[model samples]
Target: MSEPQTASAVEEERHASWPELFFDLVVVAGAGLLAHLIEDGDGWSSLFLFAVAFGAFWMIWTCFTAYGNVRGDDARLPTFLVGMAVLSVMVAAVPGIHEGHAQAFAIAYVVGRVAAARPWHGATVVVDLPVIQAFTGVLPWIVSFWVDGDAKYLWWAAGLTIDLLQLLRAREDKLLEGAQERLDHVAERRREQLAAHEERARRDGAEAPAMSARARRRQRRIDRLEKAGRVGRQIPTSIVALRTDNVHLAERFGLFTLILLGEGLIQMLNAASGAEWDRMLVVAWAGAFALIVALWNLAVRHGSAGVALLAHGAIPVRVQWVAHLVTSLALVAVAAVLGVVLAHPARTLEEHEVLVLAGALALYLLVSATVHAVLARRGGGVEDGRRAAWLAGAGVIAPAVVIVARESLSAAAVVCVLAAAALLVSVVDRRARLRLTGARDGRAVPASTP
Candidate 1:
């Protein structure tokens, strides 16, 4: 069972403060705008726009996650300011995503990352290492635009990858420090409890009154010390912080997926208005949209739910978040590609696009299922892998149904099948819950008659 929240605890934690919420909103809007800019372009320009947009989104999220993990407090106002700056750059880059604003976008992104790191740097004692490391790593990339013509992107990718890896490492270190602190507190409490028990025993058996009084005093001291140690142990660890951070990351991914869906919808609306609403075109658009929704469910709902369930002790919290973040990005990349394909004039789905989407979906489901299985095994239980198998099987069957029965099965019919499958999963979840409740009741003692 979870601990109850008190008013003081609520005040101290301040997880839902205004500034933090505002910062999240800014990220959502910025991501949507970036997706919109990419969806409005074509061919190589479209790809470039996507790269620039993704770069911006990735930089912002990385900084947010890194700082949130390191600081352990929202520090909302400053975070909001940084978010606004990112949004400003995204707005400026919207006009010429491919050519005119590339340099501006890159500079803004690099500066934003640097700025976000500053607060965390100030808070830590070993600040110079990360600061020097960040600047030294980013400087070459910032300079590469002048020196390298063909491999400029390589410089950016390399620098960004280093920063990301460093962020993960820092988070891992923080979690280790936290676990050590908790262990120390627990040990201290155990010592005090033993001392108290011994002193109480001595007091009870003591023949001399003076000796008994002394023993009582010592017992009181031990009691106070033990209480203090227990309180210290109650302080939440960095692993809990990482779990909350990953939830935020998952929410961000969900928002981006919605934005991609919106982009697809806008493209379809434009196509429909242009009198291109033939049967094949309509079927293609519907399939693309359904694919986007499935991808979103795979990444945000199922994937995140699995992570939240598994992130207990089987893996380090920081590693779990990093893995989830990578998976989320891969899903977003796949969605971006789908958005591009949907926006184009082509009616038939390309083999490469289908393969990419299918592969990403499969990988997402497989990773999540594996994590769940590991967590269950660690807890001396087992997860029915059948649910994961069902989802993956649906992913394969849904596309095939759309392709083979495009003319016979309307989009609404396909949607109904998807809904029915979702309902079936819901039924399974309900049955599992009932069984769990029954097990809990079996362990409960009957109440005495009133």
Candidate 2:
């Protein structure tokens, strides 16, 4: 049987608001600018620059989105729009990222993070301060302005790492607080129960009831250990996990994924329209669309399950955070590849294009595999393990297919190969899901589960 839902869980069913949607539209513009960064560049330098720049941009989104997730309806519209406007300045700076615009980008990012870190108009910061402490990550970015050459990217990477680590640390801190609260409540309940038992025994004109054998034994052990100074005695405690209402946050991330996919599709379509219509181009377009659909299937399935697990406190929030980060970054990189693929469907794939596509596919699947592994470890069943293994296998193989086929295969054929691999993975994932559901229902395995 399922656990009962809390009132907070029921209340968290609310969807994203219109102001949030408006905020996302501005993000879409930023994504487009980031995509163009690597459209014509070669080698890992372009990829590295794109990753760092996009990391900063993603952090900006994280700051505002984190604020919105906590504040909910109280999150101001003007504040979001002002952040959006700052993001626009950041987006405008993207085209000249390596030129004179890097400092502008860093400035906008810092300004945006500061603005979104807490409430405006003299609101009490005590309630929301811990939830939005992302501004501290900007110190490295501030130092990057004076640094020249590739060393600046090192600072950018450090800043993003700090932000990511801070998020994880904050999550740990909240968990500790929740666990302490739970421990205190348990101790209080135990005290009340003991008092009630003593009163009942007194009313009966007899001695207080004896403790259970197991409790007595455990207490004796604790006493012995304390006398020896080997262990500190503590109240009854079990594993306590911090559970919060993550439905809104999950939905927010899901929407952002959808927007990334939409932007990718738009890039593909725009590229197709610009190129001369040919059979190979049509084939490439179809393959690219299929790849996107497969990714959507994977992302949606994992995202929905993740949101459920989050609601139940079955997994760490940091894992989900990292999953979304990897998913978004991979999709952005794929968008850049899609633009290149559609722009020259008949031409041989470039070295950088092959590498970028392969890397993105590999990174995405590996993260998916990690997510599934985490789910399985949290009692999501053996089927989850099977899915993780399959995803990991595909992550390894997909890149090999890209790397090997790039030499002899046309761009369209290479794309088809990737789409085929993704489609096969999707098919396996669907079968595994069906079989798992059947098992849970105490029914026969479905005929389709080969």
Candidate 3:
């Protein structure tokens, strides 16, 4: 159940607002901290903890995101802002999370999530599955505080496993009931409009469309029943409902991605500022920029297009949002890689650094490809080999580079390879677009102008 909608809440903006921007900044700050966490801890253990920790935080964010999707920016706007602020505090404590400050961090984490889970609108919104699932999952993190050492993380493992299993157990029909609330909301609006129009007609003595004799009798009976307070029913709905503004959801998700991309550039420049004026450093910096640009194109440009596909009814919102989540995690991993490379441009990365890049790109490529495939299958757009090859190639690039490149040459070598791959993807995408447009050779508008 949702609360009554306010006029201000109903009129949404075309893009993420200032509050949304602030929320994303906090989320990205936490993601950046996770990279540092991985760097500071024991190789595999810290990485595992990072994954678990990230999942917990991301799950909470996603909970709020879904809630906002249903309620829009009006009602829950303040709640979302306050929740992210608390969540930022929770994420800030991630470094000492398993150690001295574990209790403080856990409390912040729980409070933040609980804050985000509360109702956003004046309407009586029944706390739904997204929040319920997140709170249930947070129990393990909370309980972990009572225990000592590695066993705490084990509890985390158990909690998330249960949370995920429960999510899996959710009814597909209800889970996919995607647009019922939105549909009902729309129906309510239409009803209001009809009533208003009818009132205007009566006041102005303007004739409305003529009703059949049976229709007139039905209307009279309905009016009488309403006066007698006996009319009661809910709106009828079907299974294929999608009530969300797909563009708005996509736009919000894209803004969040942009937040990370901005951070990557800021961090990279900050790291490069003090480095030696050597040839390798300059080349590495360039490579880093190219990599970021390439990633931006992959994650944001096409990502918005996928949202457009959903908005246009070419694909399911569920699949697109899932793609956004996986792709977002992968983008965070890319940010982690950028942090590593930028921090030590001249030095060769360790095996773990290489693996991080590999894993992130693997997921990014796979998810990007999958979303593109989904759009392509729906005939939303034509598939190009240039984009396809790069999408398929990134996953395969990292491990091979890490293994074969020598220590002194590895860092620059990896950067160059990735830069080339990204550049080639653009070249391929450009040429294919030109051919499609029947342009023999004048400059074409670049794909994903950002």
- Candidate with maximal lDDT: 2
lDDT of 1 by residue, 145-192 (tens): 574343555566666667556655664345345444654565556666
**Tens digit of lDDT per residue, candidate 3, span 1-450?**
332321222345466656656666677677678666666664888777777677667666766665566556464567777768777776877877865665666676677667765663212222223334245777887888788877877887777676666554545445444334665566576566556645554544444445344455555655664564333243333223224556666677777677767767766776777767678777888888888887776556754522211233234554454455566666666667775676677787887777676667666676655555655665645553334445666556654565467465657667767667656665666556566565455556555543
> Can you rank all candidates by lDDT, best first?
2, 3, 1
Off by over 4 Å in 1: 1-16, 25-56, 65-79, 94-97, 121-140, 147-150, 167-316, 330-346, 373-380, 384-450
Index of the highest-TM-score prediction? 2
lDDT of 2 by residue, 368-430 (tens): 777678878989887778877888888889789779778887788777888887778888867
What TM-score against the true fold does each predicted structure earn? 0.57, 0.77, 0.71
Q: What C-alpha lDDT values do all the predictions have?
A: 0.50, 0.71, 0.61
Lowest lDDT 10-residue stretch of candidate 3: 305-314
Model 3 regions more than 4 Å off: 1-13, 120-135, 161-169, 175-243, 305-315, 373-389, 406-408, 439-450
State candidate 2's TM-score: 0.77
Ranking by TM-score: 2, 3, 1
